[model samples]
Target: MSPSGNQDSAPEGVRLQKVLAAAGVASRRVCEQLIVEGRIRVNGAVVTELGTRIDPESDLVDVDGVAVQLDGTKRYIILNKPRGIVSTMKDEQGRPDLRRYTREWPERLFNVGRLDADTSGLLVLTNDGDLAHVLSHPSFGVTKVYIAKVEGRVSAQTIARLTAGVTLEDGPIAADKARLLSASGEGAGSLVELTLHSGRNRIVRRMMAEVGHPVVELVRRQFGPLHLGTLPVGKARELTKLERGALLTLSRRDAGDDRSAGDELSAGPRSQ
Candidate 1:
């Protein structure tokens, strides 16, 4: 269908390939290949044409004889989240939050994981549930990198203790890697970078506090293959094609699919 919402003037629904891709079957290019290969069916009939369109809200879309759900638009966005704004979609106190940044977005979006109101930096907001789950799942071992400013002179002992392990209220936690970004001569306040796979609540803060170098400021530098880059504070943008493709590939790998990259990307829709 055309970008305009005139159903009668143009087509009644979105293209078959777009429908499949938006349904999390695969990327648009791969979804087209699936259609050409006769793997996609609509209302029990094989659809091989790339120009086919159907109302996802009403039409029955099937892949390999199994129906696919096209309930809502799928969006994947990156935000250079600002401090003091909660990572959640909503706040009970009606204070600043992610919703304020995504208020113009049509689809209801949620953060892939929590980032405390006191923290800032790279945060992912998405309506795609499968990718979100795989990205945040601890078993996947996706690394979250952070750059933190701490109060006190950072010592080699501090780095060792952070990397070795520090017991928090929840359990024993350890950084996969930690290094001081500033020289010791910089004095009491120092900048440090940390890498870890844990997603526990307020973990970075707790770990730093326990190590005797309480965090004065914290910012996430990276999440998996994505980075904060030059995105201004409180601004967000849709993930680029390349970034989206790479993330989908990582999610497939995490799900234990051993198919070749090409085949895996052309794979069918996931069940809700």
Candidate 2:
């Protein structure tokens, strides 16, 4: 039997799936399945719950009876993801993943959220599960800023309709902020900046389509306090301390200050 530590070591913490992923066993979704199948043991006892938490260093975790080392350092990476690479840890169709983009890094990491394989720019990767969950959750309202080039002119009426709200097949969708970055003519295509709080699948594309202006190209320039800056496509850089702290504060505010929930919420973008 693996030796156990004081209960103090088991303070409420990151999800079990995230911890397992950071330990380099597999992705979070796979780890959740493993937990459900009773293939994981914490301190020698099988644990099947998805939300179980334990201290990384003090807890003894064994996957399929093999001890797993907990990662000691939190990792945050910013990747200028080029189109074609999937924003996932693994792909069933055998497509290239973000791992290929960060192959040179010593520590393993996972993406904060997914970007469609066809659309890409400024994808964040990290080994910190808490940060990932906080950043990805809709309730957190982390503002995502994107630049889109559409097929035809986006009229002032279309802009008003977008700002007001539009109903999609999925539901009603609205932009927190939108402005014409540049335009050619009333009938010519233009560039626009869209800031949104929701991270729905293909949201930018769908929103533009709803407004009768299908996107010709899309690029995400910012997420929360982080920016793509001048990072070249397919390249990655480590996040600065100030950036991480600001993200943490934003997450805290988003999590609604329920210290027990361990996630925070922030006042996100106000519609303008």
Candidate 3:
């Protein structure tokens, strides 16, 4: 038996194929095929042996270079946050906070990133600190898309300026994409969608104001691979298998595209 494989008929841990199936990677047969083709890695080492066993709670597993979450205690939640709720778990100021969304879950979940009290949309709550760090860290370049209702008509020239880039009091910034969804006839308001990788404080609002359109309201519609997708305001749901895989894959690619998941989490802070 390989050192990473079972020592005897009574294996120490669960079968590698069984674990992958349980995590919804594939059916048992397909998982075994993947292992045979050298596509699966356990604890950063490729294991082709059929009887390999891994501690689901502690072992690191990846399928075709994408991280696979095996630990059941780690909770991942998607919340369609409503306005007036703070992003924090517990507020020192005693204001409305995120605790209500996480109170039912036994695990101590916290928001991955942040949204201001007045701005509301998709917010992730999770107990996985490494996942949170990977998602929120500015240097990872995970893009966020926002829909803003701003004052006055947004002209094409303004849109051009936004996409080309704009300079704020603090520094220069640009939208990865900027377009006017709709503009009211009598300056009622305009809906503009912008995609950017910035996590700067009130960045969208500041950018609009600098471009001569002050924002009346803002809503984040998407973050990285996750979308808000009709999830009702103030409601939360657990991540589906596909969603989890997509996120882990993105995190894996972001961490220099070669290191193990554990190694990426253990490394020092990324350069800004």
TM-scores, all candidates, are: 0.69, 0.67, 0.86
Estimate, for each residue in 1-272, the C-alpha lDDT of model 2 and write its tens digit: 12233544543545667888976778889999999999986655677877576667555566765556564576778999888888887888899887786677777789988788888788988877777898998887888999999978777878778878899898999899899888787566888899998978999999998787898888999999999999998899987645665665565446543232112113111111
Best by lDDT: 3
Index of the highest-TM-score prediction: 3
All candidates: CA RMSD (Å): 8.7, 14.0, 6.0
Instruction: In model 1, state the lDDT of residue 45.
Output: 56
Instruction: Kindly report which residue stretches of model 2 are placed more than 4 angstroms away from their true locations once superposed.
Output: 1-72, 185-188, 256-272
Q: How much is the lDDT of residue 36 in candidate 3?
A: 90
lDDT of 1 at 213: 81
Candidate 3: the clashing residue pairs are none
lDDT of 1 by residue, 1-272 (tens): 12334445644567888888987889999999999899986654567888777767655566654446566567889998898997777789998878878877888899998788889999999988878998898888999999999888889899999999999778899999999898444455888899999988888888999988889899998999888889998899998756765665566557754243244223332211
lDDT: the better of candidates 1 and 2? 1
By lDDT, is 1 or 3 better? 3
TM-score of 3: 0.86
